[model samples]
Target: MSIPVAGRRQLNERHHRAALGLFLVVVIAHWAEHVMQAIQIYALGWPIPEARGVLGLAFPWLVTSEWMHYGYALVMLAGLIMLRAGFTGRSRTWWNIALGLQFWHHVEHLLLLLQALSGTNLAGRPVPTSVVQLLIPRVELHLFYNAVVFAPMVVAMLLHRRPREAERAVMRCDCALRTA
Candidate 1:
């Protein structure tokens, strides 16, 4: 049996919400890793190599590997671009802020990745580092970038869930929060 157009639209909205929820989980987990690393460095006083986040604990090289960082940046950029269509009004505004910041962060990572691929290091360092990283250091700069991107993205998600009536009316996805 064929579904009505309205039923299909609802089904699509549900799928979007489900996918968005999963994407949020991934984003939060990544943020957690950065937070954990910062804690290790500042509060715990662990050495940088020893504080290599969760995955890096098992694979220490992963923390220093330019490929991993570049891959994650690309993933973040793609996720932001892919999910942008569903946002509106205030949510869209906040999302654009996050997206704009992530775009620059992506550029930094791309620069580092290119240097690594070309066997070059920034400022004569042994490892490839971004231009900003030359001044901020890798671990700290990464934490800062993650915080800036994550903050606006969180605001966007919160606003999207409890949007203005006009925004809700235009939203294609059923991700809005319901009142009790």
Candidate 2:
């Protein structure tokens, strides 16, 4: 059996896919970072200061630091949802949205680094906070990870200035479909 074409909507799918993959990396990283922070809080017996935010109040919930991580993951999901909308509509807006979200990830890393140096936490508390002191290490890893995730897109976007590579990609896909 073979797949059938509905229309010429196949154009520019590769770029969307590449953007989506990067978005997913951020999503994973977001959750992973928070989880790591939470685990340290637990294992190190750090004090989790109770707090409040736009939602009203923050109750530490329990032992896992899941709330901090959960918030991070939610942002990732929002970006992914935006990407899905962008892909289906083939809208440049969606690509722009994805690009914006990816840039934010870098900002978050810098904030984390600032937190490490200044000893600030999400709750505006100082680092190691009688809990974990891995802020410096985590920020170091994040710097490298964020760069890896966005570097490809940055390079691709620069290459698209010529438009030939993206054009060739679409042509190959069309040919593959036509022959198959």
TM-score of each: 0.88, 0.29
Q: What lDDT does candidate 1 reach at residue 79? A: 77
- lDDT score for candidate 2 against the true structure: 0.42
* Candidate 1 residue runs with Cα over 4 Å from true position: 1-12
Each model's backbone clash number: 0, 2
Clashing residue pairs, backbone N/CA/C < 3 A, model 1? none
lDDT of 1 by residue, 22-93 (tens): 778988899888988888888999988799888889888888888898899988987787777778999999
lDDT of 2 by residue, 72-175 (tens): 53455455444332222223333455456555553554455455556557655544222222444443344344445445434443333323434444332221
Q: lDDT of each model, Cα atoms only?
A: 0.86, 0.42
Instruction: Report the lDDT of model 1 for residue 172.
Output: 86
